[model samples]
Target: MAERSTPGSTPGRLLAPPSLPDGAELVMRVMPMPADVNANGDVFGGWIMAQVDVAGAVLPARIARGRIVTVAVNQFTFKQPVSIGDLLSFYARITRLGRTSITVHVEVHAERDPVNPQLVKVTEANLTYVAIDGLGQPRVLTRQV
Candidate 1:
């Protein structure tokens, strides 16, 4: 399989990606196009971050059963630079549930080189979302019990 190091880093250095964590659900999959690339010919980090936010909100929106807004990005890390044409898969698992908020851990993996077939961990993040009312104010989440 073709291996490429992160942009601006030492060349020929590759780290084996860790196994995907258990209990995470596949939330989304997308491939970046030429328009998503930056001047370096790599996908822009901001674009990936935006996608992560959307993927991280999926479960929270279902649990909130109404409107939800991103409250915080607790953590974000880019393990590898994403290239156009790489198939990106986003997985998310809920890590916390508060009275009006939900925190989710998201992992993004890139499947590249269709002929060679390599899966690389590209990014991971933790984000928090809060349920909101019609007025966009945070509201307490109702218990199912």
Candidate 2:
């Protein structure tokens, strides 16, 4: 689990990737398109960042049981290049819960090569989201305990 995802024993098959985190939740999944690529042809960091923000908010939204707004991206790391056609999976877990904010850590894994099969980690990020009221003002989180 510390290294690459497990592979299938037989040909033309692949085992699923290892658990991203012990209690992480699967929040989102999407495949990149050529339009999302950068000059180098890898997925653009900004586009990935945006998707991460969306993926990171899932838990906070549930905990808050309402609307939330992104307050900050505490950290983001791109471990590997993401290529088009790779099936991307985003897993997230709440690392911290505050009175009005929740911090979530997210990891993105890419499954590539339909025939040969490869699973690689593409990104990981720490993001903070704040529960907000209809007025767009920070509101207290119900699960602050």
Clashing pairs in 1: none
Ten contiguous residues minimizing lDDT sum, candidate 1: 1-10
lDDT of each: 0.87, 0.85
Q: Write the per-residue lDDT of candidate 1 for residues 1-145, one digit (tens) a residue.
A: 2355655655665534458787788889899999999999999999999999999999998899999999899999999999999988898999999999999999999988854556889999999999999999999988531
Per-model TM-score versus the true fold: 0.85, 0.87
Scored by TM-score, the top model is: 2
Best by lDDT: 1
Ten-residue region with minimum lDDT total, candidate 2:
1-10
For candidate 2, the lDDT comes to 0.85
Per-model C-alpha RMSD = 7.4, 3.8
